[model samples]
Target chain A: MSEKRIEISQLGEFGLIDRINRQFTLKNESSLKGIGDDAAVIQASGDECMLVSTDMLVEGIHFDLSYVPIQHLGYKAVAVNVSDIAAMNGKAEQITVSIALSNRFSVEAVDALYQGIKTACENYNVDLVGGDTTSSAAGLVISITVLGRAPKSKIVYRKGAQVNDIICVTGDLGAAFMGLQVLEREKQVFMADPGMQPSLEKYEYMVGRQLKPEARTDIVFDLEEAGVKPTSMIDVSDGLVSELFHLSRHSEVGIRIYEDKVPIDHMTFETAVEFKLDPITCALNGGEDYELLFTIRQEDQEKIKKHPDIHMIGYVHDRKNERVMITKQGNTVPLRAQGWDHFTE
Target chain B: MSEKRIEISQLGEFGLIDRINRQFTLKNESSLKGIGDDAAVIQASGDECMLVSTDMLVEGIHFDLSYVPIQHLGYKAVAVNVSDIAAMNGKAEQITVSIALSNRFSVEAVDALYQGIKTACENYNVDLVGGDTTSSAAGLVISITVLGRAPKSKIVYRKGAQVNDIICVTGDLGAAFMGLQVLEREKQVFMADPGMQPSLEKYEYMVGRQLKPEARTDIVFDLEEAGVKPTSMIDVSDGLVSELFHLSRHSEVGIRIYEDKVPIDHMTFETAVEFKLDPITCALNGGEDYELLFTIRQEDQEKIKKHPDIHMIGYVHDRKNERVMITKQGNTVPLRAQGWDHFTE
Candidate 1:
């Protein structure tokens, strides 16, 4: 109640997370890993470790209901949390979703949301095991907790990357950010002239990327099929550079990546140019990619090197706390993290 | 898009829950239970069961910053979910807390919130696991998920009560509801006259009940110590009678309780009388007690009859869905559920 007003923006999201992590210590033996990595690892039955991760999405702040379909919002909610479990090199099996909605929402609206949740459950083979639904004072809120499992030997941590490990990523990046840009611009156009039909035909793929992002559980499967256990793994929810910084900090290693090797979809690149923005910048800092970024030892690279979806982008180095990008012009530059920070915005 | 507007209030909370429960079927073998209970039960390793429960508290909807301390709100959030785990006769081992706050709050405010969270974790002996922290466009929102474990043979569910089982509850009830009433009244008084200093000394117990309710994990420990496995169990969250209706519905049995047997704290009774409200009505309909309500086999009655905090208020009967209360004068009246429903409010 004191007037000492220190804005949350001053500390930012990761700084606030660090402050939170330092305050609590794990007391229970079952809690193998606490407030670090993508999920908390707990001792389960036999030689397997259970994985738990949580994500919360707020309406208006995280999504504008005007442009976002309720069904897609529900599916994205589940997918993001499942992606955290996938980041731990585990298979998500169950999810508990909690939503708080204002009465302006109808029963039909609720059903539409659940339809999306059920769709995600079917696609990911994850069961909707538990959830809490309540009335909110304002906008809708969705919080999901995903439960997953992996063998103790196979479970990966963000701190396991070592020097000479090959860094890999799944699919492409920045499409979702471009998709959001197109949607926002189209919404503005529609608002200015209600009679004018917005031309969205050419931006379908980008729009879909923004409207519905999928968790890369398939990559987790592929890694298993290739018999490669990633030395370190993390999901790319908070952009490429930010996540790379997390891996670097946690693993006590440095990163050296070729900027040209970073995968960017053609649609994403063209749209960035149309918007008068740098495509590389979008790829590096556009959050919510929901792709997998991981590292494997040099000896293990042959297993997934030829896999079409997997792209080798970088290597871990001995110099700790350093990250750089080698450009197509053969120039090295320091990497900066400009990931999503909802508080400041 | 349809002109049809079916307000969520039409179905009510339980009706809405039933609608949600009907939509999702448990697909995985690990998922043993979903919805309709205090917590969901999942299969754990080595003949053990894991209990998962979630609760979300939205500011303005669930609490008011004017009268409720931020720290107490943080503690109450964690306690409610831990109480759900205890309802299943399980020990809560880990909890994930996710919170969203607007910029109106400061870094010191967040620290106060987490300070309360850390206090509760130490008190309950539960680990602070993984969670998400984001920004809300409006007021604060806290969502907590508690994970617990119990032996397969020991885990209690709501659907296990049988005829002639003694219905019992731990500690007292109805105090928390009265506490909220007192706090709201005091808040209104202060708002009406800015210069007026509100008096709350006489209502400390009720105020404490509303602000810092504790989870009855001690009862869980006691039941283990007494070698008593409750046939059915639930936490007293939404008043005594409403939770009784749930027991009757789930166990497929009738409930009959003596009005005089319901435990009411002395301070709670006095405060209700001073407010010109019926104490018994408050006892039956007042909620947020965080107490354990369970049914023990008649044969196990002797084990806990002398236990100071345990109060036997009712018994299970064969006539399904017939819930009644016997007055102090021996008159029988049907019991109705008017428990907390935020949507209708």
Candidate 2:
């Protein structure tokens, strides 16, 4: 055998995905689309299509177990996957969760984790179906796959955005990212002096957003209720700008937005200032918000304009290969996707 | 923190699963069923129901990297999930695959794995939709979730079997187990003397069964074509006797089988003998065959008797609590389930 070795970090996550995806091609008629999307869409019988999405959360990388409750971790796992399904404009019906844990977790700990998972299942109205529980050599790993259903006419893809579609997002961004910073700070403080109780009561909302984010399934339902179908959609898992680039690339369109329109909670803004992180940058690049980002026809805007949670931040444009954001100070600059890159430092 | 530590092996795999599942309760109308079955069935908009199944394969416990190819591992991961969908008597439509690997893996290694995944997706006629790629601290882990669809009338569950139903299974068993034994033996031999070539040619058939076991999707198709819906169905992932126990427990029906009727391939039998193992025992207790086990109404037997791969093994009985096996010597004994228990010694 040859003694050549190559590290995965050299290729990075996206490079690795590209390499792997290049070898496989879809073979089934039922498989409407594969890989390179928020969720995979399958051709189901009748006028409905089935959407499938999967996500894996690893200990240390995705969350720090020191501060994250096992139950919240479980709930967050399901929520993230459901968020992906919601990104495809589908209602999640079922989810299967697989976890690999070390011996450090007790039966009580396992129960707590399941409690969170059960709560999320209830909240999202999805059934917890089949999953495998196994032992891991290291920290915990949670992988969940969610199944969703959407009418063919209402189903949205990342590639369906038109040149002039209005870009919309649900809920405020950057809270989850800021919440993570607070948690990490508290953890460090607790570690340094065991006697000092970390003050977290004032940051309850941000902390909740970080520890247990909710999937925007309600937005999916509201879109249907308002008789509006998003031309393109994606859940904000990898920052707002990263997901926007995905939509722009897949739909072959350009995007332009105003920084003032990006929703950022007041607490998040204050916390960002305290943490010495730019509020706008955090909103654009800090991910795990579980908010829906989509495009709507200009005529349909009137229907969802009344929704308090939905924020119209940008518009799709015909200028291909350009995605820019206008600053509050009147400077226009190109948007770069500095999303979460797990591989590179 | 008080120093109280418990090893996961203390509770074992099933015990852990039970502990985790006990905390979750279904709350959605769309969640027709959850956790316990081969797949979770969800109510879709149409007459058809959606099925979801998930499986996780861990390194060292599930596969040995020394002998197993990464590509085959990927294929097996998808195949196992497809088998779960087939057990529900549904047509698999979409799958989400999540992989976690350490930096030791190369871009080429990742490609090999996905190549196998893509091949299986094509062969099973299922689409690979969405998944997560993350870095791991240890060996590679693959988790797959499959989504399937079938009309409510055609869906089969483990609890549907009745007394007097004919018990049937597709393809031969024990080949994969025997193949694993052969591989282990060769690995030992090669480890002891690097210059000696592996005596693998004679065990090629058995080895293939271990390396690339196909899911019994064809049985699902054949049953549909024959217009015979199984009263109860399950895939043989854990040994045959274990699966029998599952059917018996779920359907609340007794089962009786003849040892002579169990299908054992010629290569498996020969290899088992060479390894000083019982072929019948291997057929009963060996796993990873990915075969289908089902019960059919006695009157419908005539329709499938002509099918080449499907084999009649036994019949369901009114003795709900008794599950027995008849030996070649005319002796009857209770069957024990010693399936793949990773936690057991």
Candidate 3:
């Protein structure tokens, strides 16, 4: 009830998180890991831990209904939460999805949304557990919490990376960002002329990447199969550069990446070129790829080196304050994280 | 893309949940329980199990900011999620809280909200582990997920009631509902004349019940201490009749309650009469009590009969389709559930 009001925009998302988290202290011995990790880890029993993560997606801030299908929205919601668990190298066992919608939606629409949720659950071998269904005053909001399990020794955290470890990434990036651009363009065109058809067939892959991105549970399985455990892991929901910064800050290590080694899909590269955006920049800064980013021990490099989808993009180094990217043109530039800044334009 | 738009209001809240859940099937061996229970139970190691539950509260739909303080809202959000775990006879270990707010809110407001969340966490002996913070276009939204632990043999479910079990509820009912009425009336008076000072000292207890209700975790402890485990259990977020119906339907048993056994505080009863509302109806249909409702075996009844707060309200019977309330005058009437139907007026 103080008369002084300080706007949220003055402090960005990370600043706000730091401010809020500073006030809380963990009280339970079962809480092995708290606010700073991709998912919270709790000790369930001997050598076994349970991981929990929650995410909330608001309508205009997270998605546009005109471009994103309701079913895909549901799928993406569950997938994102699952991705948090996968980042910890755990197998997701269950998920609870809570959604609030306005009267504008229909029963059929809700069914379609749950259909996408069910599909993700089936694909990830997770059970849809309990949830809250309620009405919202405005647009739709979806919140999902995923529960996962892993051996205590196998669980990875953002602060575990050591100097000289090889940094790796899963799948190609920038596609989801390019897909979002295509969807936005189509939406504008449709708004201008309702009769005109959207020319989106050529951008189908990018569009799908934006609409229904999958979590990298497969990568977690592959890593375990190869007998490789990541020293540190994080999911790339906020651009690669942003997540890299997080790993660097949390692990207290420097990160150096070769720009050419960063994987970008051919369609995404072409679309970025057509849109006059730097493909490498798009690859570094495009958010919502739902890909896994991790650092592995120098000794474990050979085990996962030949994996098809696994890309060795960089290495962790001893220089604590420096994070740089070496361009294909032989220029080294300090990497800047332009991740999703919800407060600013 | 279908032209037919069936509004969500036409089906009601429970109808929407039923429609959505019908399509999902559990595929994991670790998933011992799913959508219908208070918390989903996941098989962990030998004897331990993990319980997960989620709840979402939207701005105008669930609370009014004009009368309800943000701190109380934050506390209530955590309390409700913890109540779900208590319903499963489990101890909550950790929680993840996700929030979405518009720019209109200040850093101070966010702090106040988290202060309440931290208070609840400290009081409940749970860890505030992880959460996501984001911006929303409309009003504020809060979604919380709680993780709890219990022995596999001690976990309670909603479908385990026997034919002759005694129905029990903890604490009093209808106070939160009447408390809400008091706040609404005060809000109206204040709106009519801004300079008017509202007099609310006499209704402090009722007001607290509405603003900051506690989950009956103590009852779970007491029951365990008395060597009694509920055959079936559910938290009374929705009214007594609505929760009774849930227990009956899930357990495939009938329920009969006596009017004289229903617990109502004197202030709440008087307030209901003042508003020209039926006291029995308010006790039966009023929501947000956050009390424990469970069924106990007849043999164990003697153990809890002297507990002051535990009310022996009803009994389960063999008739599957019958749910009735016996009046003090000895007339039996069918019980109807009208518990906070969000979709319907």
Candidate 4:
């Protein structure tokens, strides 16, 4: 109530997280890892540990209901949380979804949302265990918490990447961002002329990437089947270079990558150019891709080298503060983390 | 998108919850129970099992900032979720707190909110594990998921109550509802006259109950010390009568109670009288008390009869579909569930 005000934008999202993380220390021994990881690790029993992660998606900030179907929003909410567990090299077993909505949403609309949630639960093989549903004063808000499990020995953290570890990523990047761009354009066109049917047939793949991104739980099992374990892992929710910064900070190492090695789908590239955006820049800075960005020891590289989806994009090095990218034209330049920051935006 | 519309208010809160619950069946062996109790039960390991519960609080729907301090809001949010774990006869070990706030909240306000969360964590000995922070388009929203553990042998469920079991409630009821009346009255007074100072000295206890209700976790410890395992239990969050209906429906039994035996604080009774409200009706339907309501076998009555805070008010019977209360005037009346339904409101 005082006149003194400090805007949250000044701290940004990461700065605000740091401010909170500094205040609480883990007191329980069951809490193996606390705030700094992709998910908190709790000792379940003996050599097994539980992974817990949560995500909150607000209506206007996280999604535009005009273009996003209610069902896809529900599915995406669960997938994003499951993706967090996968980032820790664990399989999500259960999820609790809490939703708040205004009366503007109908009962049939609620049914469609749950239909999508049920589909995601079946797809991920995760139980829809519990949740709280309450009415909101405004738009819809969905918050999901996922529970996962992994053997303590196999659980990977973002801080374990050693120097010379081969950096790997699952699937291509920047497609979801491009998909959002296409949706926004279509939404604008439709808004300007209500009778106009925005043709999205050409951009269906990119639109699907934006509307219903899938969690790469398959990649976790594939890595295990290939007899390889990532030294460090994180999901690419906040663009490629931004997540690389997270791994570099946690592992206390430097990153060196090649622009040409970074995988981008031809469709995504063509769409980015059509929108007057740089494809590689979009890959580096666009958010919500939900792919796995991880590092494996150099010795383990041969194990997954033949895998089609896994791309060796970069390597870790001893220089702790240096993160550079070798361009397609053989120019070495510093990589900027233009990841999504909702608070500042 | 359809011309045929079904309003959510038509189904109400419980009705909507039932619609969603009917869609998903628990598929995992680790998931012991889902969507029908205070917390979901999951198989942890060996004799231990885990309890998971979540609650989402919206700004205008759950609290009004003009009267409720940000710190108390934070504390109450955690306490309510912790109470759910207690309702399952388990001790909460870790919690994930997700918050979404608009730019209307300052950095200092966020700091205050976390401070309250930190205090609750220390008081309850719960570890702050993992959470998500995002921007909201409107007011602040907090969603918390609490994780707890208990021996499988000791875990309690709502369906475990038996005929002739003594029903018990902890602390007093209706005080929180009285507190809200006082706050709302004072707000109206202040709105009519800006220079008028709200007089709250006499209603401090009730007001505190509304703003910062504490979970009856100590009662769980006391029951363990007394060696009395409740046959069934639930937190008194939706008033005494509504929660009793829950126990009746889950256990398929009848409930009989004495109006004179239901615990009501002197201050709460006096305040309700001053406001021209029936003290007994307020006690039966007033919510947010955060007290424990459970049923115990007749043989265990001797174990906790002398405990000052634990009140024996009723008994369960085999006559299903009959839930009644005996009045002080010697009249038999069926109890009605006027529990708070945010959707209908």
Interface RMSD, candidates in the order listed: 1.1, 2.2, 1.2, 0.8
lDDT-sorted candidate list, best first: 4, 3, 1, 2
What lDDT is obtained when candidate 4 is compared to the true structure? 0.94
Candidate 3: regions farther than 4 A off: A1-3, B1-3
lDDT of 2 at A70: 88
Each prediction's DockQ against the real complex: 0.81, 0.58, 0.82, 0.88
- lDDT per residue for candidate 3 within B1-345, as digits (tens), equals 377878788878888888777888778888888888899888888889989898888888899989888999999989998999999999998999999999878999899899889889988998999999999997899999999999999999999899999999999999899899999999999999999888888788788999999999999999999999999999999899999999999999999999999999998898899989999998998989999999999999999999999999999999988999999999999999988877787
lDDT of 3 by residue, A52-157 (tens): 8888888998989988899899889989989999999998988888899988788888888998898888888888888989998888999888889999999999
Best prediction by DockQ: 4
- Write the residue-wise lDDT of candidate 1 on B233-343 in tens digits: 999898999889989999999999999999999999998998999999998989899899999999999999999999999899999968999999999999998788988
Per-prediction TM-score, chain A only?
0.98, 0.97, 0.98, 0.99
**Which pairs clash in model 4?**
none
Of candidate 4 chain A, the 10-residue stretch with the lowest lDDT total is: A1-10
Q: Which run of 10 residues does model 3 chain B get worst, by summed lDDT?
A: B1-10
TM-score of 2: 0.94
Off by over 4 Å in 4: none
| Whole-model lDDT values for every prediction | 0.91, 0.88, 0.92, 0.94
Tens-digit lDDT track for model 4 on A1-345? 487898899999999999999999999989999999899999988998889999999999999999999999999999999999999999999999999999899988899899899999999999999998899999999999999999999999999999999999989999999999999999899999999998998899889999999999999999999999899999999999999999999999999999999999999999999999999999898889999999999899889999999999999999989999999999999999999999998
* Better candidate number, 1 or 4, judged by TM-score: 4
Candidate 1 versus truth, CA RMSD in Å, comes to 1.2
